[model samples]
Target: MDPQNYPSMDQYNYSNNGGNNNNSGYRNQAPQQHQQQQPQQGGGYPPQYNQGYQPQQQQQQYNPNQQYSPEQQGIGMQQRGGSGNEFLISSISSNPLAQVGFSYGQSLFNDGKQYVDSNIGKYFSFSSLKSYFNVNTSYVFNKIKLIIFPFPQKTWKRRIYRVGDVDSYLPPRDDINAPDLYIPLMAFVTYYLLYGFQLGMGREFSPDKLGTAISKGIVGWLIEIGIFRLGSFFSNSYSIPIYDMIAYSGYKYVLMVITIISSILTGGYISFFVKIYLVACLGVFILKTLRVVMVSDNSANSHHDMHQQHEGSAMRNYFVFGVAMLQCVILFFFN
Candidate 1:
């Protein structure tokens, strides 16, 4: 309390406080002076220099190299976003129906892209459909490159497989004109005979009526599908004929029918599909002749223009169905 009276106020605690205050002033001044002298290294902005222009630290760019889990693979070929053909391991699509349809399209049946090559079996297969210059498989492969035409054939093994890559992947074949004449003939015969027997046994065997209905159904279906353009949308992805799409739809029905009806019978679905298959085969042989005869018949009457795509499809279908009907007629008489 009597500090002023002490022998040396300068040596007391009061003096020590004064010296400590001076030391702090010196320590703070050094940092400010050093900062003013040193120039910030990086270009453009400076680090925390002017508040208006706070030098921003350069942000490190995003590293794609960072490991990603399976879930982080981003959008892949398997995910059905834009197109339905993608495949994902365990993802439910926003559009469930599209997802299912796309899945079915991509995986099984190779998305309807396989087995359309007319030349795989030399004379019997697709070779007869068109006249090739060389008939050599090598030349055919080059011309039929998947880029120009996308077909749905398989790898060397012919076993079903996935094709995620594009460089090597070929688009599905548009025309599958391969014909198996012998088997088709037999199949055509069996189907009609069987159909005739079934109707006859049912006590409602009217050849004329049944023939008309079946012919109309098949012809109508083909005519409708044959005329479809698929526009530019489907054109980029596939070269499939509208006829096949329509025919396949009907054919799928036929195949299903074959599978179901034939199942109970001896051959299962094979017999039914085989009949149309035979018809397809027979069409191979009879196409030229049918065209000449049928065209001439049309020309004689001049019923309608033959150049119309729909008319052509109808004509083709008519021929195809007539052959099927002929087989059925034989069954009506005999079976």
Candidate 2:
């Protein structure tokens, strides 16, 4: 026989049997673990080949929707710290000293009952009252802003006065030099004349009726507008360091109460219109006066700084008060 016929030693095609592994019982093990199963230092059935057993590169975990950067997180923190409720920068200076003083003063006034304390230092007690007066007076002042006559803030100037200031949220003046002096004067004149005529004619007025009546028409309109102006002027923009602002504001409120009382006496409280407002006026005046007397010039300065913040708030108040005083005089003589 030839050598070709005798060479049958390589008849099997051993290629891991193409690794068609239907049995995971052995394939589930790691390749390294499978090597441990070999016969000790001798021969064994050849180890099974597993191409899928290589170590997989470890994957990093991530949530697609939760991604964020360090810069964005820092910005979020800063925004929470910069909110404005704790910092009303427009009302007072940013200086730490000023801020401290304002806060102290605000706290001092926030507690009103401390003023009657006899055991405490009188200055502290006085400070308490001063705070009380400052706040209450500001409220009263707002209630009577319109009595500061003549140069009233032109609410509907486009339709009514035809005059506006430079920073006007309203229309400009029709004639700059005219001053619109007589509008207030004439309206007030009509008011007093009607009052006297009704009184002289012995026409008794019910307080409620008169109050209700005066609340109508151009006259009532003017009164409402005046009171409205007075109230708005007492806002955060108001600054009067020397106590002049509050003092002036209180005086105007008093005067306005007097005017409305006089008018309501003619028309509203029905039967006792005069008596009601008369009592109200005297009561408010005396109470305010007592508070004023209790406070020193220093205490009065509590609201003084706001006057300087904007010259216009107090200036306008002063000018209008002058007109009211003039109208008051006019009403006094004729009525």
Candidate 3:
């Protein structure tokens, strides 16, 4: 309770706080002096000062408004020029003529594809004849069937008229039994080839002989066309297209080739018998085929009866028969 005996509060508080204040002041002043005395090479600086140096280096390294070296500018311009040249060359390659040519080639390829699709089939393909240069074995057999069995008949010898049936009457289109250019072309070629062989065998090969052979074939074709036109007019079946008539007439050449081959192979009385049989078969084939296609269906059943009654029809039949017989005589004479 007495002033002398009580400890002073101010003295006690100063003794406790004075040591902390002096230690803190010493820490702050010691760091500043260390920085001023230390060299910059040893990295003796504040964290803020080091950070600020990085920014200054970055500022020096990159400035958007700074001018590039002439060499760098030239390199950039050269790269741009090279890109522009490549673009121009590419644009020229895509020119109108090149594009049109590509389109034309594509169209030709498409047309060829269409032709193959339309002309190639199983029983009635262009590959049916060996003389075609590239033919299938199946085609050869079918062609033999077409030649030997011109008239369609069932197992019982009854006629069938459905399309695509192997033993049915072909309606001239979309029918396996229908005639095509393969056989006729082969026959025509065979005719000339046979004639050429004959000339070669006889030691009479000449360019003139070749010309004669070609002329003969051309004449025969023309004569067949004329005969077909006249026959078509007289028979009242002008509906048969010219090509059909040509194809029909061309069958005679196949018979002629047979006669020539037989003559060449068997040059005796046996050949004569073969020729007679061939002529008879040719006559029958012409009679039956023409009767159906060139003659009216109204008289199909009563064709013999109608021929007797109708002079014009008789004359037409006689004319067609006369043409068929002419082939027999020509086969003997030419070969």
lDDT against the true structure, each candidate: 0.43, 0.41, 0.65
Taking all chains together, each candidate's TM-score versus the true structure is: 0.24, 0.21, 0.49
Alpha-carbon lDDT of model 1: 0.43
lDDT per residue as tens, model 3, 1-335: 77898778998889879988999999999999988776454376666677545534334467688888898879988999999999988887879887788899999999997777676642234433322233445654665455555556322111356556453433333343344455666788887888789888989989898998799778978886787777667765545555556666776677777777877888798888777776666666666666555344334535456556477566667766776776656656655
Off by over 4 Å in 3: 1-177, 295-312
lDDT of 2 by residue, 1-335 (tens): 78877545444333234344534536666665767754332333233443334457888778788967898888976776666544656445868888899899998885654554644553233442333232233333433333333233343111233345432111112321111222333444455446545645566656655555455434533554455345435433222222322233233333433554456456555434443433344343323332322233224345767555345444444444443443333333322
Q: Better model by TM-score, 2 or 3? A: 3
- Arrange candidates by TM-score, highest first: which order? 3, 1, 2
Q: Residue 237 in model 1: shift from native, Å? A: 5.1
Winner on lDDT (1 vs 2):
1
Error (Å) of candidate 1 at residue 207 is 1.7
RMSD versus native structure for model 3 = 15.5
Candidate 2 Cα errors over 4 Å, as ranges? 1-56, 69-252, 261-335
Q: Write the per-residue lDDT of candidate 1 for residues 1-335, one digit (tens) a residue.
A: 78667668557777889889899999999999889757664454566654565556897789988887776675674364546544343355666887989887788676343544333343233433332121344433432232122234232111123557522212223222321122223334454555666677669789796686557545744453443323212222123333223322232232233433553475645665655453443333333323433443344345545555446546455644454454333222221
**Deviation in angstroms for 81 in model 2?**
17
The candidate that achieves the highest TM-score relative to the unseen native structure: 3
